[model samples]
Target: MNKHNAEYYISKLGLLPHPEGGYYKRTFQSEEQTSDQELSVEFEGKRRLYTSIYFLLGSDDVSHFHRLKSDELWYYHAGSPLTVHVIDEHGVYKEYKLGIDLENGEVPQVLVPKNSIFGSSVKDEDTFSLVGCMVSPGFEFQDFELFTQDELLAKYPQHQDIIMKLAYDLIPV
Candidate 1:
């Protein structure tokens, strides 16, 4: 076994600024793929934080907004039609759609900061994407917060009463 210090490896993992939050760093890249049906790595672990990968079914509205104690990176592997949205600390939100001004080269990626919210939507069928979250204090499944429409409406009724800025597309499954 290759014994390595977790802290050392964490530093080597390369953390970068998340587009949504300022409290975390994230890095996302693609891996060699021999087939369209290959399993992808969603998350990687090193020291202070780990990574997460996700698979979005085509046309399925996937909730993206989430706040983590760490940073997150999203890498688009297969499937051309995809949309990602994020809300910054200032409550400024932006949505990105793939295939629009999309360059033909490395897979596109998105960075999400700690304590920020973000979400994604898949337009093509049979789509796969990878997400990497680097938690400064590491991550625990218990810390995962999956929000629902009713719950969000109940919690932040003031925000919901406004203009319905957030659209409910998917329920936790």
Candidate 2:
């Protein structure tokens, strides 16, 4: 058997002992100190892992398209009436609404594969959700690109374009 320092072992395995801070308001850890979300890690010393847990304070309204390089998991630990919208590369789109009042404690998990455009919104007053992303080979902050409503309007002056892309009626942010 051989002995290795903590940092050496960690570096060899590309582990992130400490999850990225400020990405979420709170976090949880395992007894071994592994993160509940594993928000970030090192990637062959080339890139940093990117992970996040979204905590909705109370029925937040968010509408922005983010293109992700890695797969992601959405875990609903609490709340109800969660909605997820995904757009594929072929310009196809669909919506998935989850949870009845009884599904609040059921702990449903949804996975979005890599190379998909996605966004979400919470409809219930007490609704909240957490998301986890596992970016193979690591992820970087620059990988995230947000397309906000204003940018959409500027790019597509036609009302039908907005509806086709986002599936909603835009009344100015």
- Judged by TM-score, which candidate is best? 2
Per-prediction TM-score, please? Answer: 0.49, 0.52
Over the stretch 52-98, how does candidate 2's per-residue lDDT look in tens digits? Answer: 44433224444445666666666654344556666665556666664
Global lDDT of each candidate: 0.44, 0.46
Clash pairs, model 2 backbone: none
> Taking the tens digit of each residue's C-alpha lDDT, what string does model 1 give over 53-87?
33332343354355654566555543444566666
Colliding pairs, model 1: 16-26, 42-52, 42-53, 43-51, 43-52, 44-51, 52-131, 64-118, 64-119, 65-118
lDDT of 1 at 171: 41
Off by over 4 Å in 2: 1-54, 98-107, 125-127, 130-139, 150-173
**lDDT at position 17, candidate 1:** 29
Question: Which runs of model 1 end up more than 4 angstroms from their true locations?
Answer: 1-48, 98-107, 124-138, 150-173
Error of 2 at 129 (Å): 4.0
